[model samples]
Target: MAKDNSRDTGKNTIPKKKGRQSAVCANPLYPCAMTGAASALAGISDMGVIIHGSSGCYYYADMAVPDTLHSTFIVQDEVIFGSAERLTEIVESVSKLYNKIAVINTCVPSVMGEDIKEILADYDTICVDAPGFIGYFDEGWRLAVRELADSIPINNSNSNTNTNTDAPLTDLSKDSKGNIRVNIDGVCSMDPFHKGSLIEATRLLNLCGLKTAAVFCHDTYESITHPSPYSVSVNPDYNCADVMNRRLNAGARNSTDSLLGPDNVLRTFEELSDRLTDTEDAEIDIDISKIESECEETDEILTKEGDRYLRRHDPPRVAVYSTYAYTEFACDMIANYMDGEIVHAAARNNPPDSDLNGGENPYNIGGICSLHRIKEILSKKDFNLIIGSSFEHAAFPDSAFVGLTFPIRHRKMLYDRPVAGIQGALYLMDEISETLENGNKKSN
Candidate 1:
C-alpha cells in the first residue's frame, strides 16, 4: 500500500537506523503508567490503583485487561500543575473507601517532570511512577512490579519471610536448575490469557512438586521481592524480564511460542520437571512430538483454507498489524499455509528479532508510528487479507474488519481451543476463512 506524502526529491526516503549517532542517546520512555499500576496491584496482598490522568486513559485501561478485582480512576485537570496533589487525595480517599492496599499511579505526568515520588514519599502508602512515555505498555507493567516489590518491607528479623527479596536471578548468576522461581511477563489490563496460563503452569509444576514463586500480570508485583518464589519466567518479554533478572535474581523464562498455546505450557513444565529430577529414571512423559504432529495437522488445514482463498482471490496481498512477536508468527504461518505473499506488516519494535524471520515472505513495512498511517496505507491500496487488532480502522476506515487474538491477555493461548503448534495453524485458518467469506460478501 502506498500514500503520496509530499516527496523530498533530493533527500533519502528511508530514515537511517543508528548511524545518526551521537555518542549518547536517551532511551525510550515507558509505554504507560497504568501498565505498571496494573502489575503492582496484581501482586499486593490486597490492592487497587488510582490512575491520575484523563478519563481516556482510564477508558483504555479498563479495556486493556480483565477486572478480576475492583479498580477506580481519578481524572486530573490538565490545567492544574500539581496533579500529584490530586493523586495524594485520591490515594487517601481510595484507602478509606476500598479498605485495601492502595497505589497511586501518575500517567503522562511522569514524563512531564512531575515529582510523583516526592508527592507520595510521606503518604504511608505505596505510590509508583507509571509513565507510558518511557516504554511500551508491557514495560509499564514490569516497572509497577518493581515498585510494588520496593514497597514490601523486608523485615530482616522476620525469618518467616522466605520469599524472593534479594535480587533477580540473572544478578545472582545461579544455575537454571537450582533457581526455583518463574516470572510471567507481557502483563497489561488488555489481556488476561496469562491467568489461565498461570493455572496451567502451576498445575504442571505441582506434578513434580515445583512451585511458581509468583504469577506476574497487570497484578502480581508483591512477589517481585520473593526472588525464591520464581525459578524461571513463563512469559518473559523485553519490557520486564531484564528488571526481574538484574534486580530480583528471579528466573525468567517465556512460553515456548510467544503466542500462547497449552501444549507449550505442558512442554515447558515437562522440561522443567525433567531438569529438576535428579533420578536417572525420571523422564518427561508429555510427548512434544505429539504437539508437533498436531501443529502439522493444523498447518495443513490452514494451507487448505489459504489455498482455497487464493484460488478464488488470486495473488492475495495481505497486511498484518500486531505485536512484533505475535505478528511474525502469524505472518509466517499464514504465508506457509497459503503459499502466498505478505506485502506489508505493521508492528511495534519489540524484540528478539528471530520472531520475524518467516523464511518465506519477509515483512516489508516495519513498525508504524500512528494507526492513521496504517489506515492511509491500506485505504490507498488493496490487500486481500488483513490480520490485526481492530486498530486497522485507522488505515482502512471503510474496509470490513475482524479482530484476531494472539493470546496477549487471555489465560489460554486459544482461550480453551488448541491454537498453538498446529492447532494454532488450524484455528487461524478458520479465522481467516471466516474473514474471507464475510469480507468477500461486503466487498462484492
Candidate 2:
C-alpha cells in the first residue's frame, strides 16, 4: 500500500460501474474483507455476523464459511434509510434473543457515504459499531476483535475466569494455571475446507496451552476471553492479528504462508504451538506418514499419467485468481504440490496504491499492483486450468476450470468431504490427476 489516506479526493468514493451488475462494486472495498475476517476471528459456536448491506453480503459470509452459522442478518431496507436505529434495536433484540455473544457488522452501502461514526456514536453506549467501509475484511475483523476485546474487561491480575461460560474456547480444561490467551489470525478457505483448518488450528493451539480468544468468521466469539499478551496467526497472513495486537498492546506472529496441505498445516500448528505455548521442542504430532506415503504414490501415478498423456504435451498453464492472499497461497501450494506453474496469480479487488501504516492487516495480494496490469498479464498468459470460484472462472471460460468453495457460492457438498489438511491435498491430487488422465484419453 503506497497511497496516503490524508489525500482527500472529493470524488474519491469508489465509483459505481454501468451495467446490470452496476449496483455493487465487483471489487469489494476494505469493509467487506474486514467483515469476513472479523467473522472468521469470532469462531464458530459463540459468534454471529450481521452484514449491514443487502442479503448478498450475508450470503457471502455464509458461503465463505459453510459450517459457520450467522445467527442474524439485517437487510438492504435497513441499510437504505440509516438502519442504525433498527440496527440498535436488532442488536438489543439479538442480545436477548440468543444465549451466545453477538457482533454486528456494517456494509459498504451503510458506510460508503454516510457518517457511520456519528450513527454508531449514538449506540456506542449500547452495542459495538462495526463500520464496513473503514477498511477491508481484515480491518473489519480487527475492529470487531478490538471492540470485542474492549467489551470484555481485561483483568490480567486474575489467572482465569472460573465462570465456565466465560472460559475461552481453548480453555476446555477449565484450569486457571493453564489458561493460555490466544488470538487467532490469518485464516482463510483452505484446499479442503476453511472450517476444518480452523478446527485443526484450535486443537493445535489447545495442545500448546494457548486458549483461543476468538475465531473470526461467523458466530465464533473467542475474542472477548483470550485477551493475552500474545496473538498467534496460524496462516501466512497476519494483517488482522497484527492490527488487533497493536490495538490490544500485544505481540503477534504468522506461523506459515499456507494452511491447506497436511505438511503446511502441521508446520503451522507446530510453529503456533511453539509461540503460543512458549514451548521449545513440542513438534506437531499428527500421523502423516500415511498421507505422505499416499502423496508419493499419487505423485508416481501423476508421473505415470503425465508420461501416458500430459508429459511434454504442453502442460496447461494456470491462473489461480482471487482477492484473498491465503486463497492465492492455496493455489500456489496446489501448483507447487502438483509440479504445475501458476502463470498468473491475481488479487481481484485490491485498491491501487494501497498503504499499510501499522493499520489493519493488509492481507490480500491485489493491492500489489494495478488491476489493469493484472488484466494485461492475464490477457497474454496461456492458461488451461482456471481453478477458483465461478466468479474467477467467469473471467477465463476458454480454460478448463474447477470451482472451489469461494465466498460467492454455496458448498455443493459434492462428495460429503472436507478439503483442508490431508483431505485437501488428496482432493487436488485427485482433481489434477483425473484431469490429466482425461486429457490423455481425449488425446488418444
Instruction: After the best TM-score superposition of candidate 2, give how far the Cα of residue 301 lies from its true spot, in angstroms.
Output: 8.5
Highest TM-score scorer: 1
lDDT score, candidate 1:
0.47
Alpha-carbon error at 285 in model 2, in Å? 11
Off by over 4 Å in 1: 1-45, 54-56, 63-86, 96-114, 123-125, 132-139, 149-184, 192-213, 218-242, 251-274, 277-315, 353-365, 379-381, 394-400, 405-425, 441-444
- Worst lDDT run of 10 residues, candidate 1, spans 19-28
Which residue runs does candidate 2 get wrong by more than 4 Å?
A: 1-44, 52-85, 99-139, 161-185, 188-192, 199-224, 227-235, 238-258, 266-314, 327-338, 349-379, 405-411, 414-420, 440-444
The lDDT values for all models are 0.47, 0.45
Give per-residue CA lDDT, model 1, range 49-130, as digits (tens).
6666666666655555455333334434543555766667666766664434545354456556666667777666655566
Q: Give lDDT tens digits, candidate 2, residues 373-418.
A: 3444567776666655555445554556655534334235444343
TM-score of 2: 0.61
lDDT of 1 at 219: 38
Under the 3 Å rule for N, CA and C atoms, how many clashes does model 1 have?
61
